[model samples]
Target: MDLRFDHLIHAVSDPERARHAFADRFGWHTVAGGEHPGFATYNALAYFGLPYIEWVGVRKPEVAAERPFGRDVLRVLRAGEGPMQFAVRTNDIVGMADRWSRAGLVHEGPIEASRVRPDGVTLRWRMLFPAQEPGKLLLPFVIEWPAPDEVRLADLRQSGLSPDPAAAPRLRAVHAVVGDLARLRRSMDAYFPGVLEPCESSEQGRGVRWTCGEVTVFVWEPAEGALRRVLDTVGERPFLAEFERTAGVRTRTAADAARRLEAAGAPVHGLWVVTSE
Candidate 1:
């Protein structure tokens, strides 16, 4: 599978605010706006290291395209909240998609040159959705960038991005909570094969301890309860607070972060962050 951190998603109401917040507070640099066709979004890029952070905002109806993942993005936009989605970069889009298809996983076709980053870098890949059932968090979507180095992080450094290694955001880690845990692990095993060797976790939660250069993903077991508890824990002081301030967006604290987040009026389904290097 050769999976690694591709990017983390942050949902915002105002793209401009999110951009400035990242640059001024966290020292992350953002490229200009680019179109996300199906998702109807105007997105920008910020880097932790190689894999950049994708800050996406729903575009106005006038210039926007179809809403890809149904209307989940629009919901997040209403809330003006934290991490929305995460992606894994595969070495081969076609081969991986073929394998997934053989395994009976349902996904979208490999759109030739589907999405382009704001830096003028074009990404070529296909996306796969979980088959039959949906919302099982083990594997959200699989993406493979075309080989021969179409878009390297180094190429975008000239766009007001810093070369200093220390400028990267201090990402502690990334965490996800899902209704199913064991099934999620099994699904990953079937798809990615031997790629789970370095992961570590427990019953209370499922976590993959990242190597020195990789980002960790903590997938917790979800229970039937008010979404507030889940949101609260993720937004608890140190992480969400610092994120809002450092990222320069709203929702910097527990007291009102939830309220501000929900202000977008989107159903708070799930949230996660891709920590910086």
Candidate 2:
């Protein structure tokens, strides 16, 4: 499996609020996000760069059904604020799982699902989850089949309702806060090997750094004030603003990136869209 970062999911309370936040404020365009019968909810994908942002909301009770993601997705729907979960991209998901299993990081299968676009295009793929709780700084996952390129990520980037010449953002890194930096780092070291660096922290929270190619990942638990500001900013709408922010600082080190986030006062919690140099 060519393991890598896929897209990040920022679960929101009102899918519409999520949509408008991206579309109206940031000028991101939405591709027809498919509907899930099981949850009676609908979602719209804001096709950014390669990884699109999905704004998901709960559906009416009558429409929702009992299914695998039903309860959990509903939980995200209710929670409201996001940076809910992050996704990993892997071309060979099955092989990656085998590697992970050998490394002792318990994991689940690449569950299969499909999303149909308005123009009759269907995206079919499989996904896996880390053997951990959902809320924790999410672990990496895999995506396989039909390759991400065949899906034309760049095409979707051009589909937004309006385009700002400055529309594209370079997502430099994504940071999450965790309780046990050493333990988590150990898990990543065992499974992911050389990718993560030694853990670090401040009065704010524990920090662990992971580097994927040019992208940097810093997992941090910030001070109360920072956390509250993050929640408040995302509670209204999340992904778009984030995607825009991170889109700028594409190839910087995690520490350099975090400093920018600190200056921005948003902290790298949810979706971040860094601007390109």
Candidate 3:
């Protein structure tokens, strides 16, 4: 069972605004991502190599309010803008869902989902969402892309999105805020065995880190109001902060990114600066 980090979902009030803000701060342009039709949501995508950033928001409140997942995303937007959830990709989605079911973990679907690009090419995939729980937000939803691994990047480029492989910041790690470290570790072990390792945080707390291909995921105790919202709704969600490692030695610091975000008027809570070697 090999699970790879797919993309990070950042819920914002305006996908276009979020896209421009990201461009201003990171120097990477986001291409137009089409609407979710029946779900009443749409997105703009900032593509990296494999993992990317998806800035999603509601286009129609009434229709989106009808669905549980749609409503969940909308709630995050209502609270403010920042990361709401992340996803993991697998080649065998059905097998993965079976494993979760056998473990007594409740989940929904291998649901068929698709989006039509502006060029009229439709990209389709299947997804599985875990049953909502205290730490459910910390757990990634499973996704299976139909295309072969090698052509995934090319497919995105063909869909009329500009993915600057050279300028796009590589995702270094995803920081998840959880209540109980031991319990989350147990769940992760069952889903993807032998991936996590105990680690120390620079912020004076303990955390567990795991690598899925090129990206690292860190789960630690909630540190801010935004993180606490992962368990509630008033603040934000499980994604406390995201760190990016740039391609150059003089990449922008967190403070620089914060200033850029502030100037752009985007929510700066869950986003950190880009670090470089």
What residue runs in model 2 are displaced by over 4 Å at the alpha carbon?
Answer: 37-41, 60-66, 102-105, 134-137, 148-151, 154-167, 199-206, 223-277
- Each candidate's TM vs. the true structure? 0.67, 0.73, 0.81
Quote the positional error of residue 276 for candidate 3 in Å. 2.2
| CA RMSD (A), model 3 | 4.8
Q: Can you write out model 1's per-residue Cα lDDT over 113-190, one digit (the tens) per residue? A: 356655565655566544424322335456665553334545545555434445555333454444444665676667
Candidate 2 TM-score versus the reference: 0.73
Can you write out model 3's per-residue Cα lDDT over 113-168, one digit (the tens) per residue? Answer: 77887678787888898775552466678889999777987776665464656655
Cα lDDT of model 2 by residue, 1-277, tens digit: 2455666666656666667665664556655577665346667766445655666666664444354444555555555456665676767777777877887777767677776666666767787666755444345655665655645554454544223435555455665545445666666666567776554444444455555533456665444455325434543222322233433324233344345455453322245544434
Q: Model 3 clash tally?
A: 0
Minimum summed lDDT over a 10-residue window in model 3 is located at: 248-257
| Sort by lDDT, top down from the best | 3, 2, 1
Taken over the whole model, the C-alpha lDDT of each candidate is 0.50, 0.55, 0.67
Off by over 4 Å in 3: 134-136, 158-162, 201-203, 222-270
Error of 1 at 101 (Å): 1.4
